[model samples]
Target chain A: MDLPLAIQCEGVSKRYPHFHLQNVDLSFEQGTVMGLVGPNGAGKSTLMRMVMGLIGPDSGSIRVLGHAMPHDQIAAKRHIGFVAEDMRLYESETIAFHMDFVRSIFDSWDDDYAQVLLRRLDLNEKQKVKGLSHGQRVKATLVLALARRPSLLVFDEPTTGLDPAVRKEVLDEMMNALADETRSILFSSHNTLDVEQISDYITFIYGGRVVESSNKEDFLDGWRRLRLTNPHNRPLPDLPNIKEAQQSGQIWTVTVNQYDDALPAQFTQAGLTVTAVERLTLEEIFLSIVLSAKANIQMKVAS
Target chain B: MSTSIVPQLVGKDLRLLSRIILTFVVVSLIFIAILAAIWDHVPAVVQGNFGFILLIGPAGTCGIVMLMKTNVLEKEKSTQAFIMSLPVTVKEFTRAKLWVNLPVFGLFWAAISAVAFYFAFARGLFPLGGVPFVTMVFLGGFVAYTCILAVSLVSQNLGMTVLCIALFEMATSGYLWAIAFLNPISQHIWGAVAVWNPTAVGIVAAQLLVAVSVIVVTLLVQNTKRDFI
Candidate 1:
């Protein structure tokens, strides 16, 4: 059976004086983790805020757990656990105080799970939020969000400023959150490795637009970097899904998005000798996608 | 499942601000006690002036601090996002702030006003004629506070919030100086019986009107806000 959609954002757009997110459409099924990968100022937080109903879109509609956004937000938020990088608890208050506060509002708060998380994450309940280090604060907030046992989790760069061990710990806890199979998560991060590790689906957003979004496997399988021999110094032939091309002497490096077994045969048919076809990592793929999109926007402006 | 989260949000704010609230209340009460103890030692007029200064100063500071902590600081420190993450809408959050701030300040205002009234009129500490003046001053403070609260809620900017407080405070000083010299109010400043002249009543009525109007307008404006955080 097809899973219900946890989030559906259709043609959503938001405008500011300096930026505009235009005609964006995104959705993901329940029980799947969708990682939103974007560089700074790429509108990831804006999109997540819309999903969390903290802000309304300028146009189009967003639904979280089947409830329309900004209207049914109070209802939709009941099942959503949101933790953004900038989000903070009461500074003078203790972690215990925050947990109690969250417990008071959410009926789904699991005390047992909270205690487990606290112990596992090595958080001191009596310590004030102001006194905790950055990593500790992130962990505390994560515990608070997770202990609510929300059906949908929306995180915006949860592991943004952390040491490697802490980042891994956070990523591990995120993976653990999925053991239930009913919970869905949409997390935004520029850290492609974290996204690649935990996300079943990956979305790359750049310059207020979604550059690419697909399942992790599809992303891993569909992108390839080919080093071709161009002894004749002839121009590269037109190829489908050519993301970027660079030439150094007789060697031509070309990145393609729609890679398949038949791509090499097509290269041969075009009088280009494929020297090597290499799989692109998510980081390389993300960078290529963003650069390609930026180049496209610049070309459009020039035209 | 569809119940309003205003109460819980209000409760959370109350809990977070409990210590500050307690400190202000205790300090205000102690100040009142010290003033009452020295009531006969100092001249009545001087004592009354001191009392008004002492009471309004701390009360105003308390109200400003509360507004800063709950409204301005929440946005500045990004705790507003944390609160918004909960099962509450921006409208509900605004309502919770209204409930948290107005009533708490109202209670503080009313309690101190009652204590001042009892000492002045009931305890015969000052002439009853000062009642209308004192009431106007107290109500004026409420109006100033409501203005600050409204500005804090709408702007959510620390600079604007502080500017609103400063401007209102200066305006209040000017208002007090001007009203003290008014013929109707000045004539009754030392009378044995209280006089409810049209000027005194009008000032008090206007303060109440402004206070209520600011709060209502704040809520209406907040309801229309599309982006909260």
Candidate 2:
């Protein structure tokens, strides 16, 4: 049996006066969490909006849950629980009003689950949204989205601008929601810690293009920071996945996307002594990729 | 599931505009009471000439201002984000706004027109010959209303909304004066026999046509929006 994909974006490009998302092809299986990591103005929100059918892509096709986006979006959105940083509840109304409103629209609304989430999220149903704190506001949104029991949850910077405690609470709730194998999640964030903690897959995008995308373990295990000593002041070794290499005196620090046991042997045979081969965290890898991508752009522009 | 969303959205908009609805109801009741109290003791100076103005003036002004305030003139831009996130298409949203807003103005327009017509044609307090003129003037309210609603829904720009309001206000005021002095309407203004001259009927018919056309054009324009957010 073939499980349907939750999201698919092929050759999806959106152009603005100041920004563009060019030919982004992405997909996630039915039961996995994909973290989209990108910097400010890097088109993460644009991509998410395109997937939600909020904005039509300038070119290419987007399919969410097997429905063509922006065309069958009304039908597609029935199974999508989307929350963005800019999206907010009615401020003048009480939380109960919003809950009732959402419940009336969606037959899949789970009242029992909504009540459970209200307690776990520490939200008061009677409290007006304007009176809630920032953390409470986010929690209320989360409660509303989760209680709908959508097949896919898409979050665009959901935990942005929250304190550490609130961020952890939100992440914990998201992880708890993903326990069902049939559900899928896609969240974009600048906070790599949040992404690293809950993401099953990671995709790095920069300058309106995806630079790296793979399983979380593969990314973590495959990338490494190598510390080497060129005692004879030799040139840097040629490696297929060498992303960035910097030298100070006779010591060299090389960041590679593909790292394995044989990499040390290759460096040794190149007349360089390998001193330390340390694994890179997701944050470090993201930074290295972005920096390398920026340098490559500069080189192309210069040439 | 998607079929029920339009009603759901319309229901939400009604809830959002409930305060305005209540205020409208209250103001209409007070005006009706005032008209009932003054029915028997009309001043000779105002009698037989624009007596219904006292009723229609407040109703028309309040109808326009209240509709614009609750729907078109919203500076907060609230509820849009939440509404857009749901399983609603642009057509559904536009339909909901139109469904909720038009009837709101219609209710007030109907009540005010009914009260005025009752006193004029049925009770014989005001001259029946002025019915066509009053009808045409009240229909002017709808023209202003459609202008504001269409512009606000399409542009969502404060400047354009204000411009529409200003143009409609100036045009309505001018048109009312122009129609009141027309030979066909003023010739039979104080007469006992009710008259539906070509000018009066033509103006009323034209106003209704504009109202319907404005609504149809607005809905069609709204359907063209690809970027709803």
Candidate 3:
């Protein structure tokens, strides 16, 4: 399972006057999309900036595609295409003008494929960049970026402020962009479903630190929500996987993050009913993860 | 080879710059044309010669706007995203700007020179002598543009722009006074230090010195401190 890595950062740090992004480390392999989710101002954009070589870290090295960043950004960026919700287009120029402008600069530009995206995204070739709606602007930026055939496509909340239909269009476009197995994408979002639907790897960033980073399916595995009754009044077994247990009167609810095949038998032996074992979706997992991380931070702050 | 991103970056800047440059060109052309049409009507040589000095205002203002405004424009739009996404390094971005706009400012200076030559020739029927006039124009413009560049690089807002201009003037005026023995009339007289006074040789040397210093400062400012990116 050795994957050729695309980006790697170790001991990277950045500090503002009041806020600090302390010691961050992250990595992603080639061809795998990594979703970075965090609360607003949680340093998601800052970290991305560092990774893109838009800003250099105060200390530590960053390697993207095996080249050191900021020092190597010029070469690295040849393969990297980035988009933000606030896509900066040449406002006074038409979409065709920008296509030519970008095309002249990058030899890899695919004019035919660009036309295809323009038609598929329902954008006008002659439309002025300033006149396009926000959703259309996103589409235009996406088309410009995608047509370059960039190996690393980074989207920073590409769906923000987009209507549901436009969001789906963008999401579908992203999936299409991934049809090439050697290409990769990194996008940050607050929308868990977007990540769950598309990402192979998910990293949860909370309060300037990565609280969780793992394969998407592996994270969803070994966790469950259980609802049971305490009517028989049997003491629960010493379960290694139980994260939290709550009991009210004759009813008990339990959450186990590390479950095994013997769990139902063990519950039966303990004279308690295992009424349900339901799976937690990505959104639910996000909520639970955020709550636990916040609690952990607070406990550390208190101690 | 990557077609130096500088050109791409400058292409975007020239769009915004043309508005200011066009405005200056129109106004300067009209003023110069009107002055040429009325040169014989009655004016002191000193008044007219000094008026030539004031042309620096419009041209210098245009150059400063071209450099400073374009530098901050992307930051103003979406400070977090615009520059952060670009692969253009801060040094390359800043140096491209400082170096590129010189030619832009040079074009403005050249236009002003043409206007001055038209005015001078129209005033005198023949042999008006162009070297001194063009030299003064270039000298005045070089001083104005570079001083403005130094200040604009460090300042954050309009108030700071005003303050940078004021500080630059105070420092250079000190040099102007010291060079001539327009001598500080006081006894605590290091006020007569070497940094002040503007004589021809000293001023020309200072112009060259400022040019080199601009390169260094431009590199330092862009490399050392970014505007909260």
Off by over 4 Å in 3: A1-4, A232-249, A263-272, B45-54, B79-87, B117-141, B150-159, B165-198, B225-228
Top TM-score: which candidate number?
A: 1
Across A157-240, the per-residue lDDT of candidate 3 in tens digits comes to 888889999999999999999999988998898888888889998888888778778888887886677777768799987886
Name the lDDT value of residue B187 in candidate 3: 22
Q: Residues A1-303, candidate 2, lDDT per residue (tens digit)?
A: 886799999999988898889999999998899999989888898999889887899899999999999999888888888878767787788889989998998899999999998988888999998898878888888888889999999999999988998898899989998988889999999889899999999999899999889999999999999999999988777777899899999999999977888988988998999999999989999899889989999999999
Best by DockQ: 1
Per-residue CA lDDT of candidate 1, range A1-303, in tens?
765599999999999999999888999999999999988999999999999888899999999899999898988999998888899888888999999888988888999999999999999899999999899999999999999999999989999999999998899999999998989999999999999999999988988898888999998999999999988777777875999999888898999987879887877777789989999999999899889988999999999
**Which whole-number lDDT from 0 to 100 does residue A64 have in model 1?**
89
Residue A206 displacement (Å), model 1:
0.7
Specify the highest-lDDT model's number: 1
Judged by lDDT against the true structure, how good is candidate 1?
A: 0.89
Higher DockQ: candidate 1 or 2? Answer: 1
* TM-score of every model versus the real structure: 0.96, 0.92, 0.85
After superposition, the stretches of candidate 1 with alpha carbons farther than 4 Å from their true spots are A1-3, B122-126, B181-184
DockQ (Cα-based) for each candidate: 0.86, 0.62, 0.33
Worst 10 residues of 3 chain B by lDDT: B185-194
Per-candidate interface C-alpha RMSD? 0.8, 1.5, 3.5
Colliding pairs, model 2: none
Report iRMS (Å) of candidate 3: 3.5
